[model samples]
Target: MSSTQHTDTLKNVRTISTLLYWVCAIAIIFQILVVPLVWYAPGWVEASTSQMTVSLADLHALSGWQKYVTMAVMMIPSLVLAYGLYRLRKMFGAFAHNAIFQPEPIRHLKAFGIALLAQTLIKPLTGAATSVLATFHRPAGERVLSIGLSNAEASTLFLGGLIIVIAWVLGEAARIDDENRSFV
Candidate 1:
């Protein structure tokens, strides 16, 4: 590529990276703050839980402190996802500064990958916990403890593994580039 073309491409990358960084930041904020508040709205709760295939009857039965606790339990995966987004924001920030192949970006990429895997693993447990919390008000035989794994979780696991491998490759490339620079 011509020097001008390369420079323009990097400029475009920087602009996109900056946009992604802000998007990640906003997403994290929304997950952490706005989501729990929105959960209190019955319509929103019903819509979201129904989409997840969770029993609306169990959810509707929750009240008072049970609702708060159930909401907290359901937020676990989102919190983990927010942490991953934070790492992604850091990586994008480095890219925005033209530090794409640096250790900082690689580190953030690896951390983000780990966070994704962690969230995948945590999701099922949290789902079960949330179900139990939602139905805990019921009598002993009626309380629910449900565990589920879906294609989405499998896809997340695969994506997380791919990202970790990519981060490893980038780290090796950065190391080689540093070694080559040392000879100059």
Candidate 2:
């Protein structure tokens, strides 16, 4: 492409990246704050948790304290997700400043990938913990300690690995470019 066209494309990338950065920021906030609030509502909780593989019977069995503890436990995955979003935001911020091949953006991408991989593990654990907590008050035989993995988790694992590989490739390319420039 011509120099002017390349410059224009980079400028467009910067604008889009800036917009994505803000969107990620908003998503982080929503994940941290709004999601937990939604859990407090019975209808919302039932609607959301109904899709879970592990049966969560008698969610009402949880006392206020138990519910709070469960909510906190559930926040573990949300916090992980927030961390991933933060890394993504940082990556986008770097891109917005036209730092496409810089180490900072690549680092952020790798971090985000790690966070995604963590979510695959942490999410199932948290779900099990939440289930146990929710059913703790139940009779001994009825108590739940269920652990399950869904397609979503598998997809996350795959996507995370892919992103890490992409980041590695980008890092290598940057290194080669830098070396080539030094030899010129």
Candidate 3:
């Protein structure tokens, strides 16, 4: 291909990639904010809908403004990070196809595995933390960190969080390998 054609192709790829990166980032951000709020909302608003008791005592305390701020803070970055990592994978894939060191994809894959394993560790820890929080809650509604949520609920949240992070890390690792392979 002509040099100009190659340059145009690269630019097109970059544009497409950047758009996808932002989309993923936005999703992650939405998850971050929405998950926690939604998680906590069960007992207050939606419990009847579920035909069960679901306490979101933890989130009940946040004022309207605080909720918005907290939601943005938590969700936006979560999305950015996840989306960035996912984008990395795609970018690397392209690099692998074009570059010399195709073997790098293996490295990325391994790193993804490691990330997944590492991410798995967080839920249990979060659970432990939640359990600890629960003990101190004493039905007092005092502490913000009170492990008020049932073990099952907390575990689910923890697990979901872990999965998100692990998925992101795995994506990043995979991309790394892609880039590596591209160099060869």
Q: Whole-model Cα lDDT per candidate?
A: 0.85, 0.84, 0.47
Candidate 3 vs. true structure, TM-score: 0.37
Off by over 4 Å in 2: 45-47, 51-57
For residue 38, give model 2's deviation from the true position in Å: 3.4
Cα displacement (Å) at residue 25, model 2: 0.8
Can you list the residue pairs that collide in candidate 1?
none
Local accuracy of candidate 1 as per-residue lDDT tens digits, 26-91: 999986874465455546555455324257556666789988787787788889889999999999
* Candidate 3 lDDT tens digits, 3-76: 99988887776666557546645655654554465545554446432311213443344555645554444343
RMSD of 3: 9.6
Candidate 2 RMSD computed on C-alpha atoms after optimal superposition onto the true structure: 2.0
lDDT of 2 at 34: 48
**In model 1, which regions exceed 4 Å deviation?**
45-47, 50-57
Superposition TM-score, candidate 1 onto the true structure: 0.89
